[model samples]
Target: MGFHGIAKAVCRALTVRQDGPSLYDVCDPLLLKYQGGDPHLGKFYRTALGNPALRPLLRRTGLPALKDAERLTRLRAALTAARDDAAPDWTAIGTPVAELMDDIDVRHPQPPAAKVTARAPAMADIDRAIRVCGAHLLRSFARNGFIPTYAAFNLLGDADISGREMLMALTGLNARGYKNSTLLFALARIFIAHSPARALINPPWRGIAEPMWEPVQIRHRSAYYDAFFTEALLGFVETGLASSDQAGAARRAISDMVEFCLKTSAEEVPSHDGSTVNVITALAPGPHPRFSRFFAQIKQDLGFGIYVPDCDTTACAFSAATQAGADDPILDQPLVDFYRGYQVRAGANEPRVTVPLNDHIDYEGGVVTWIDNLNGDRPYGNDLDPTLNLDILEVSFRNLKRWKIIETPQRLQTVHRIIAFQRRLVESGAFKNPRSHIYYLPELYSAYFGRCYAAFVALPLAAQRIIDPGNVFALIRARVLGYVKDELIAHEMNPFDAALALMALAHLNAEIATFTPALHCIVQNLGEGGRRGPYKAYEWNKMKTPTRILVGGPEVTSAFALMSLALARRRMAHS
Candidate 1:
């Protein structure tokens, strides 16, 4: 009988329920009809039913023992003949079934026996990484008057630093000497380019005007850029880094950008509405009370919760809620809903849930063309969205605890689910594939995976139960360490990936010894003008190779490198 027929027969014979308690439950209704008419068949069915779990095994293994009266008589005569001849030949029954049985056994083999060792990093190693990365940044500044937008490119090229990248660069050079001055001058050039006549600050993409800096255009402009720059500029004014005129200009620009973003209708605002909400929330507590009002208004219009249409939107919402305040239902509901939406029931338990980071495509698209949204509510599967999902989990865990959004039991359960999902992905070798998610290139996989590892380490102790319930932590730790050893140490590391890897190691409190070689590699690869090499390449055609495209300029690379080193230094100090 075919497997389906066998399943039906077995289900009927065993009185098993269809759509039973668990996913493994199997049933059908025909065998009972045969059993009612024949005592012999009923007796055979009772003997063959065996274990509930093993019952399905017979379908694939075949029913060699099951025989009609005619077959049984023939088998008995053959056996008698063989016994008389003193040569029992079983080959006449059928080809040997041992090979098939062996294949079945192999199909469900045990998990691997490999154990991963976690290495502790030393303070000296961290210090060395910081020193090397810092020295590299200084070297680049000495070679070029201004940092190139990309580590590998000469001049600014097509890339320009966003306000957020600029802010990070400024933060990195806050106390440094001549390098600080160069950074300030670079900031001044940007301010000059975005003067009233140019009107580049609030536009979709701002380009640096020629002569002073590279003439480069930035697209997908939004209020977030303005808010980030405003925050940075105001910081400069507070530190007395900016002159009176510069401060005045910054204040005016901040006011204008805020007005532009808030006054415009939601329909009128650029595509990334979630980003707009996040930027506004980020500015809420900082010199802009109006930001809070705008945040509330947007939330009211969009409804209470993280935008489910995309992972970035959900992540941004979680981040905004965490930053907003404590016990605020408006901000907290979205996170709670988001967590609930992605939770999947596991095993026989209703409460036992797992958070699988599944991908959802919002639209289809070309490189430069906008992704067409044929169906906004539907989410098709892809391999790349999991990175952002993990990102959301990381931010959610940190903020939810800090803000006390949910109860302890619920929070722990959510954390456990996230960890389980991550462990399954890593063990299944999904991370090894270079599938494109948001970015066009496969190289971004490592960067996102690095971030996922960082998130794993950032979880609280209750949420990080890898030893008792499972050794998921050790497995993830091994994979992360291996990633750093392979991608960061063995190969040339890009600033973005390097930054992410460094942050992951720091978060895990991994031995600085493990990452020192990777840090050194980054230092060695530092191009002229305080930059790193081979920016992320994006392409439209699947068959065509993508060109190395620089993003956010030298400031981004330098900022990330400095931030990584700084994080390492801070961790070492505390340790």
Candidate 2:
């Protein structure tokens, strides 16, 4: 059929009544034609519609372009057909529909408008954010002295970020005359209680020999917690708020922890190369200078080489070495070799280095797919794995120069190549597109994007231009502003996510105006005892799932809120 003929057929099938819902919201004919009679139609629909390959065709054909009235009409019709028909060849319809739309767009060209500058934040707005974030933090502190990480219907007791949150809150509050000494004391006790006892012998198992701090209440132990708790304890000790004995004990615990990690039989230790480095880095800043032996032992055991299991581990290790004044060119050769092996060819002329978050790998049709386990092994598989490629680039860019890796021609080329890759990722919408594997939960997305903002800010002006010629930060600023606007109007975000979002904006030095509304909402939502309670967890789609699953409590949420406020205040002062 001709373009007009197909357009009429599709529009007729897709058109909704004036009072009806939007085309996307309504049932589409194409969906019925292809997906009907299938018990798993929902899954099939998402796969077909969300496919990255199909996105190009859809965009080129102008079939599903966002906010295109003509394309919406055709898409609505096709979707309705797929929904209703018992059996239909999706490829047949999709191909023809795409061609028709492509022909139309070619005939009538209408380009999108240029991007605009964002509104700047006002001083009053900054003041309001600090006040609200501070109030929310105080109100969200639990009776048990911990902060809930998320305050939603699904999560209540989860303490994933509890240690870090408490540390940040303490750091922030310590600057303001220790307004919450009771909370600080409670947190100090928790940190000390969680430290591994020096008297205990190392476990014999190869799987469990790594020495790390274990949380008091949580059963699962990870390197992330080990690094976090170590830093928190060290920070607490430095404040001199704890009793002399308590401070001394903390220092001893740190020493013992380092010794245990170093003394553990290398053969028995599982490769938590990243965590070990993090522990060393955290200890490097302490008053004690006994970590040189531990540092040397770690280098011997893990080698200065890059391990594929954790890409950022090598960077962290190098950074720690530099910080401790033990940096050596010989030690960096392994990382150099590792980076050389990890370069990805983007096009015939462009190549970039990328660091995968995990070691999960799948080979399909000669294409290697790196699986991300940021959220763990969930039913949705690797769909939620955050492609932290930009984050890796940022870490590499910020640290490699200090380690002198950038001095080599090959290494400098890799840096330039990665910067080029980062530019493409942001410009091509790979960072935010769900079709690409990099898209993550909104809060996580904000966090990663914030890293990009910070990295961009740190870049030399010339380098910044090479990485982001289009001024993408303006777009990011607009998005964050929109988020703050939405939260102010609806207040639907959980406390942890809200705090994270605030912190991300602060990292970008986003206008204070964008933060005020959300901060106000947080202040208004505070419950009694300065605690925000009952946090949410990730929703499971499995059969017979409970309506609500408690994950975090007041401790995590309160700490995060406090940290967010502190970040905002710091940014505001500088601005």
Candidate 3:
């Protein structure tokens, strides 16, 4: 579809403000569309920006973009150099991908002070690791009490930025003359704890002694039951139960099928025997229905995060991670391989060129077959094709990043408070549930979560205090720089995750204006370029293909948009 088509769809999908559409509405879809065959949409975008009537409307809507588009262009050249290293020919005067990434990191380096490196899709395990790591830091500080990192009770000191993204953003801060690593490290360390998981792990149950029984953070304490805020954060409260049996049940189910398949694979043709018939049925003649069932079960098992019974609190106040015992049997690889030759192609076709083994597709024919059926043998970079993976790579970093900050910026003691509560549950055997149990999620245990507001606010504040964060005209250049960094990094990421990062970063920027009033200009200046990308029909479809399975989740996208809106409203009111 054309740009207009996407604009029309967006208008239909979201309820724009009574005053007009939000800046997100004005820009997100194109950024969401990012790539594909929609030149008409690009043309419309250019025209809309140029038009006299729409220009102000666009400006008034205010959005984020790169601070230096030209600088970003240079950054992209560096990023390409780095990415090319992903599959470098060492014989051709080249460095490996990892080293090149390090080099690029150095070239566009964020000043070093305190540092932490993390991988994507922050799973449950990472939580505990941080907690354990924090324990070491805490032990050193327990003798003298820990203090909040900011040392500023004034709300004026506040600005939203993710711990990691904001760390990288220090380049902007350094340009403005705030050259203190101790301060940034103190802030960076504080940045780690801003995750929703803290809602559960570090609940203030002692608040129960007060007139209000609910967690201390909630706006309505007495009105809402005890642990209400806890429930709001973690989806449930834990009673300290181990989920070994439920895990065993799921394991047994998979093991039985795996055994049957292993035995069946011994025989050449398919069997009608009952033992081997669990995953296969003669009704469809092909195993597609059976495969569908397998897929469903896999999702169910992994997604089955059970809620534990409440201990003088709301239900689901302390939920446990979906249990999977490592010793528990794994899926039957042989059984999984049964479908490898289910549909043999007539002739041998050369393997399609991809981003060099991007994923180890144990079961290949399926993803490609699905892609080909959607768009036939579109040869490698046929000039018409951008050849991108269409699967959603879900990300969960911002929530996790927000976890460490609950302590005191440096006060990891917040995690200890949470562990104390969990220990009570553990000793009292509150965690003995047959189906769901609350074990000490020592990893996820932290006091607070990291949040992002738009950088629009601080840019001008820094401008006034020391230097021009960016001139009114120069701010867009920075946004362009940011987008190139984001999109280039996204090359290695699944498109879905990439889209999510963009949206999250955009909302973060939008929020910044709330804390610093002058930021709205930065917000208005960068316009859509700060937060958007070129949306095209083909690219949208490819990205959406994986999203279709999860498409019913409008909640995720809407929540993100709401965050951006919250930031916008806050900024507007203050401005």
lDDT of 2 by residue, 411-478 (tens): 55555555454444444444443223322333545555665566667767866665456665566555
Q: lDDT at 36 for candidate 1?
A: 29
lDDT of each structure?
Answer: 0.36, 0.35, 0.22
lDDT of 3 at 83: 25
Summarize candidate 1's per-residue lDDT along 1-575 as a digit string, tens digits. 34565455555434433221111111113222232232322222232233243344222321222224454344334323322333323233111211111221101111122223245345455444444434433343345422223111111111223332223223322122211222222322222232221122112211111111123212222333332233333333343334476556545544554443333211111132232121122122222323235434432332221212333333443443333222333343334333433344443222221111122221111011111122232112211343544555555655655545355565555656665666665676555443323322223334444454555556666655531168775786677667655544444344445555666676566776665644553454445342243222111111100111223444334445555556566655565
What's the TM-score of each model vs. the native?
A: 0.41, 0.41, 0.18
lDDT of 3 by residue, 1-575 (tens): 34565455344333322233322243334422444433322333333222343333233331122124553344334323322334322122111111212211111112122112132222232222222222222221232121001000110111112222222222222111111221222221221122121122222221000011111111111100111111111211121111454234323432332332222211223311212211211111223112245433432332211111111111011110101111212222122122222212223421331211112112122212111211122211110110110000000111122222222322222222222323333334322211111111110010010021222233335322222222321333234324323332323322222233333333334333222211221122221211211110001111110010101111121222222223333334464
lDDT of 3 at 311: 14
TM-score, model 3 to reference:
0.18
Best by lDDT: 1
Give the runs in model 2 whose Cα sits over 4 Å from its true position.
1-218, 225-308, 312-340, 346-387, 416-425, 428-439, 459-491, 521-559
* Model 2 lDDT on a 0 to 1 scale: 0.35
